[model samples]
Target: MNVFEGSAGYYGRYRPGLPPEAVALLAGAGSPSSRPRRLLDLGTGTGLAVKALLDRFDDIIALDTDVEMLAIAETDLRWRLPAGVRLSLCHGAAEEFLPPPGWRADLVTICRVFRWLDRPAVLARLNQHVAPDGAVAVLADRSLWTATNPWQQAVRSVVQDFLGPQRRAGSGVFPATPEPFGQTLRASAFSDVTESFVPVRRAWSADGVLGYLYSTSFAAPHLFGDRRDHFEAAVRQVLGCFSDTDTFIEDNTFVIHLGRRPA
Candidate 1:
């Protein structure tokens, strides 16, 4: 079973969008040129990054392995895309996707799902299609599981009790990235690598937290089998103990790593 098999609804409904500052940085990186502007978004879960960039690129290609995820993205983008923008939604993996002949992209973005790809192979593939002045932006951010707040800790404890101590994904445990993302990019064909960080703070309700957990592969609602409601109730009860206002604040750091291929 693929980790994201049945979680497309939760993912599309609960995942947060990229911050304004991060979007601005990506826009600023573009240079004035006569070449056709294209954007390729890999691991584009429910089209978060692609939607954020619809106004910036003339052509957008969004790729994801899950058919259901792409279907949701297609539905959302049909109304969200700006007038005159062309959108292409491809169902494929980052390591295996190939652009049409003569297709080159002005920008490529991989959001939270980069860890699941073969880094070197995908980077090599991007290098073949990235325009001279174009860049590849890799977005990395911590999930709610990394939160240190008391309410978050309590919720995590309840999940651990039901799902066991390991972080479950698909048929295997999630593996950590073997090396720093920056180091991996530096070793690739790209050059002029740089990193930027944006600090973000958001408030979440207990229900919002539950929705967010269900959106992830490790904690989807179906994982609880017939005890889904019971698990949610337990999480709600634990969160209620830590908050009087029914809201918990999350402070997150979003990191963007930009690497450019020589012109």
Candidate 2:
């Protein structure tokens, strides 16, 4: 089964975005031209990141491989954007995105989705669309599976107890360790690679945690099969042991790796 199948709704509701200051930092990393700034957001997910960037870019192309996810973003942003601002939501792979003639992306964001792309091919593609002084930001925040909070651990334990140990992602399994995305950026054509971390603390209630579980590729609803309700119950039971009211404070450090080509 596709990991993202039936996961779009949950993703839009539960996935947290970068903090406002971090969004400002990401927007500032690029040098866009006057009048209309263009932003190419790859793996736009629910368009949450694009929504955060509405004021940052006048012309935005939010692209995603998942048609369902892109549709949701299109629906949400269509109403939120001011009149006259250009918003084009494309449903396709990042490499397939062809902007209008003379359209150059001032900043391109690959948020929490490096696992889904061919790193070298994407870099090569960016060289064609991105401006000479443009910036590319690879962004991500820890998910429940990777989070070390006591409540998060309990949730993972419950998921493993139901899904049987190996973490499933799409048709295969996720790596036991984290991928080195920064190394890939450093080796790409975009030079001046730098890393930054933005700390954002959030509190998750039982409902929030439960909703987030279904958003992940590893713990997606289909992975539970007919036992999804049972899995939720088990997760709730385990979570109760962690907090009385079933809420947990999670301190997340959002990561940003910015790379830019020489002007």
Best model per lDDT:
1
Off by over 4 Å in 2: 175-179
The pairs that clash in candidate 2 are none
Q: Write the per-residue lDDT of candidate 1 for residues 133-241, one digit (tens) a residue.
A: 8888898788866677667778888988889888877546778746877777888877678999999988899888998999888897778899999999999899889
Model 2, position 18, has a per-residue lDDT of 75
* TM-score, per-candidate, Cα-based: 0.95, 0.95
What TM-score should be assigned to candidate 1?
A: 0.95
Model 2 TM: 0.95
Please give the distance, in angstroms, between residue 231's alpha carbon in candidate 1 and its true position after superposition: 0.9
Name the weakest run of 10 consecutive residues (lDDT summed) in model 1.
27-36
